[model samples]
Target chain A: MSEEHKHTNYMRIFWILLTLTIVEVGMAYTMQSHKALLIVALVTLAFIKAGMVAAYFMHLKLERKTFIAIVCFPLILAVVLVIGLFPDVGFKLGGKHHHKPAASQDSGHAVEHK
Target chain B: MSSVALAAHPPSQEKEILGVSSGKMAMWLFLGSDGMSFMGLIAAYVALRIGNWGIWPDPTKVLAIDLTAINTFILICSSVTMVKAFAASQEGNVGKLKQWLFFTMLGGAIFLGVQVYEYSQLIHHGVKLWDSAGRPAAEWLHPAIQGHSTLFTATFYACTCFHGFHVLSGVVYLAFILIGVMRGRWTVNRIEIVGLYWHFVDLVWIVIFTIIYLF
Candidate 1:
């Protein structure tokens, strides 16, 4: 009944999401050799699909700007937290570099750690 | 401190914050915090996967991508049904609302069922939360990755199982909402709130399917 909900075409958004999902799965299968490109493509497609669901299905786009900002603040922080931790974890900096020597020594043996 | 200042800023009215009902605002806040928890799990998974790099088995080889891709489509359809339910509620079409809500719950139930099946198959194939000492790793695992089976198994189960739990919870949540609708005890606003939660579950799955299963 509200003006905000009037123009929403839920089916249209559904079609878009479905198409993107198909593309994502297709890319996953076809881009096996291009690891970097596949990761970028899959992540990008996932984010776009997520954005559409949030904006349309959740009716977030119909909400007030302040409310949208409130919802997004935590999301932005989540992205930052992942990216910020990447250097430390992804690269195995700090004492994690020590894992290499032990791992190499173990070779075929199962290295058990708690 | 003056009477004019007091008059200019008279007692604030008890109104909806952020132009939305307090209940809806609270749901958003809960979701924001919930999203952060999932992000933490995802970040941990990524860190572990990247740290294991070469030893980290290809996810597609370990996971059933075709089945999961179908599951992803089902979740997306459920999301659409959820929104349709909300739209019907807003239109005062109780019959349509009930129908769509039931469909949405059905979709969630199917998704959960498929997840349970997948988990069982994986477990039957020797994948587990913790690999026992001296045990040979699952055959599907990369041959060179000796001790890292636990890392792969743990992170895979943790992420997927957590999301599966959310799907189960969402189905139960929608069941209650559907019951409320049947009894004529629910409001359009409540439908919208539940719809937000459903859509969020779908959104989280979209990301997980890509990062965990596809990647």
Candidate 2:
């Protein structure tokens, strides 16, 4: 009941989200050449905006710590899932072998070799 | 027997699991699972893009960044309105609650409309779910992709369309809640639950927009 009565400055959170979004778009355009840096910056800004919304707007900040811990479980799994895929997809370990046939076709070597 | 049970344990003594109402806890659980689904889609997108890093078309070159940025702003505005509605409900202000809820729904509707428009434009420019011919008519498409698979457009359509459907569903869900409010059957807890769903939609979009459009 005490948590329910807590005050949240929804407008302030709104402004922060708005400002972060503006900065995201501006960085997207200005830092396109530095692809890695741009991705890190934009993703960081996005997470900040999302965290603010969840905390202030959704009132997760007012909830019990146990409830917050419960919510974090799936999010942690999601990060794990992404990182697990890095070796296969991101590094393309066996990808080149699989792509060989298609690469040959693209280079017109398939018809010539046949 | 029910009356005896109720008398034994008054409403105030009812157990609250982790200090959350059952309804709100259920909503949070659902949001968590739903978030994992979106994460799956996003992970697939990242995998495809990385696997074909050299040939994957630059998103900024193909997608309308400015339009989507504006659309993102619209969605953020709607999230704010949704929270405002919840606050109004907490205050027991029916009139203000209804007003803010209507605004939130309007924002979602506008967002969906813009998404449909963007889809149409992309389709006109030759983006398809699966191009059997293996040639999308987009000139900006890489020469290497002319005769290969259309993973770029395919993943783009899949991710955006799924999110668009969520927005559409959210609008309809809010419409039902708005009807309930009109009939004087609304509760603060109910409004708060729906607001959680709405805000989660906004949250998912924040990630998708960055990974899909801005990345």
TM-score of chain A of each: 0.73, 0.75
What are the per-residue Cα lDDT tens digits for candidate 1 across B20-133? 877788899999999999999999898888767776877777677888888988999898888888888978999999999999999999999899998877766666654556
- Which number leads on TM-score? 2
* Best-performing candidate as measured by lDDT: 2
Q: For residue A81, what is the lDDT in candidate 1?
A: 83
Candidate 2's C-alpha runs over 4 A off are: A1-8, A93-114, B1-15, B130-149
CAPRI-style docking class of model 1 based on DockQ: medium
Question: Candidate 2 clashing pairs?
Answer: none
True contacts kept of each: 0.78, 0.69
